[model samples]
Target: MSDRRLTPELLLGAYAAGVFPMAETRDASEIFWVDPERRGILPLDGFRMSRSLARRMRSGRFRATLDRSFPQVLDGCADRDETWINGTIRDLMLDLHALGPAHSFEVWEGEKLAGGMYGIALGGAFFGESMFSRVTDGSKMVLAAALDHLRRCGFTLFDTQFLTPHLASLGGVEITRAAYRARLARALADRASIDAIAMDGDLQAVVQRMTHTS
Candidate 1:
């Protein structure tokens, strides 16, 4: 299917089928589907919290929020030198967000957006598309809080799509495509909502809970 034919329903259906669209560059007008042989996923119960990340989490230097400034978060994630989030993808995501399952987790330094991540949430699985950081450990902070939020909200699978060394250090692991499909199937059959709980609680308490759990 062509990128021009891609709609919010089609995008969500693609995610349900374990395939996603990508572009050659941010300016690319066309997009293609990608279904990797290996999938990167962060096990909800297996996130690694190092001393520094834990300390940073408890420092109260940043606050975490959900679905706030999603458009800004999208801009942040695509602000890099090279990105696969082209205009078509960005527009589609915006439409998806309006239709509801898509969400963004944001980390803030006072009124500034330090970092954030966005993804498509279907049933019990959250397909993390991209994240960006404007400050040190900003993306990491968002990831930590996103994981905690997902866990508390009853999500079962956190699909990072591809594992990077950064995510590997934070407990992301690669699994066979078959294994990933199995997990995805189960998750799709289950039920969860990223918006089920609010992020209005204490940041330090989130860190403490993650520290004890991890």
Candidate 2:
């Protein structure tokens, strides 16, 4: 096992090696390493946009942005009860964002923060840490937009770490640790143009490409 120093660079290094850190609770001071037996990932070309979800996205009811309000997004994800985002982890997120590699996809309805997500990216790999939603389908919208951005940015592996019903609804799947590490190594060996994502953050365009990709 690594030293688990919890610095921004150390965290990135850990992610590159296919492990991540978490805490038992929001108030916990210590962080622990997590390398699950089965890793959860959403196939870049297999995101689902059901009729109802499609309808909401097409309606243009919300807007999305990247690297905007990162702290808020992190806070939102940690707002729930029994969160793993302790103060140390939160500081690491802030530090990582400042040093680059960490990013957020924020969704807003008018001036209100509706939903958002944050994660880390390296080469062609992206580690989706957490997400939150204040309104219905908000997190899904953020995810759809994120996938499009990732695809455009040339990212190939979207690691979710764990599977949940919410993630399953969006085509998240579990793979053996060995298979996941294989994919991770491949992704780390490749290069992806992060600049291709730009700052536009358009949802309709994302939805349009989703059907064509898979």
Candidate 3:
């Protein structure tokens, strides 16, 4: 289908049906649907924080916030050598953010944007789209904060779409499409509020909660 013509309603419907929209390249105007054979997911109760990362979080060098810079997070994710986020996708995401279908979690080191993550949320399922980091432990801090937020909001499924070494280290795992669909079904069936829980942009508090729950 044409990416330029993909509306927020169509994209939401697609996600509800267990597929997602994507562009082939940064310059591509046509968007395509994708349902990979393998899916990447993070266990809500298994998000791992290494000892060193825990120390960093305890050090309070960074702060985390949610939906603070939705557009900036999307732009940062696309600011790379190779990206599937084209102009159409970027605009759609921004629209989704405004409509509350998309949300972002950002980590700031003082006044600088250290790192952040953004994604789409439906029911109890959160589809992680992308993340970016500009300083050490920046991305990790965002991920931890996001997971904590998701858990507090009663979300059950954290869909990464694809697994990477970076995600795997933090409890991301690959699952077959069939298994993924089962989880997705359960997640969609349940009701959860992505914004029900409030975060204070406190990195240490986030870490303490994650450690206590995990």
Candidate 4:
């Protein structure tokens, strides 16, 4: 393992090498690299939108946006008691965004941020870093938009890094590192443009598309 600092360059390099960085705690100044034996990923074409979530999508109570409120989204993800996002990690992600290697999706209700997610985009792979929700179903709304956008953009992989119960409910699954590497390689071989798709944040439209394709 290389003792590289968590600079933008190092972070990008780590992702390129199929590893990611994490801090020990929210207050930790130092960061470490992670390459888990079991990797969590959401199938772009297999994302599950439950009947209730689909109804929520049709409710039109929330709105979603891409690459908006990125910092706020990052902060929201790290707002919990235990977090790996420290100041250094935050700055690094911001730098990645500036270079167009990172992107975010945000959910809003009126003027307040409801939920959002951010990640690094490389070729056809989207490495999900984190997400949060303030209101009910906010995170789900943001995820729906993200999945739609990624599919429309021709992305082939949605790497969540690890699976949680919440993620599993949305069709997140675990795969061995070898399997993940194979998928990553294939995804990295293909290229997709996230900017090519013009996405509407309207919940109904998002669900309509998801239902039609999914």
For model 2, what is the C-alpha lDDT against the true structure?
0.88
Runs in model 4 deviating more than 4 A are 1-4
What lDDT does each candidate get? Answer: 0.89, 0.88, 0.89, 0.88
User: What's the lDDT for residue 200 in model 3?
Assistant: 65
lDDT of 3 at 72: 91
TM-score of each: 0.96, 0.95, 0.96, 0.95
Query: 66-143, model 3: which lDDT tens digit per residue?
Result: 898999999999999999898888988988999989999999888889998999999999999999999888888899
Clashing pairs in 3: 3-31
Model 2 misplaced regions, further than 4 Å: 1-5
Tens-digit lDDT string for candidate 1 (90-129):
9999999999988999999889998899999999999999
Over all chains combined, what TM-score does candidate 2 have? Answer: 0.95
Measured over all alpha carbons after superposition, the RMSD of each candidate to the real structure, in angstroms, is 1.7, 2.5, 1.5, 2.4
lDDT for each residue of candidate 4 in 42-90, tens digit (9 for 90 to 100)? 9987778989988987886788888878888988999999999888888
Candidate topping TM-score: 1
Clashes in predicted model 4: 0
- Residue pairs with colliding backbones in model 2 are none
Q: How far is candidate 2 from the true structure (C-alpha RMSD, Å)?
A: 2.5
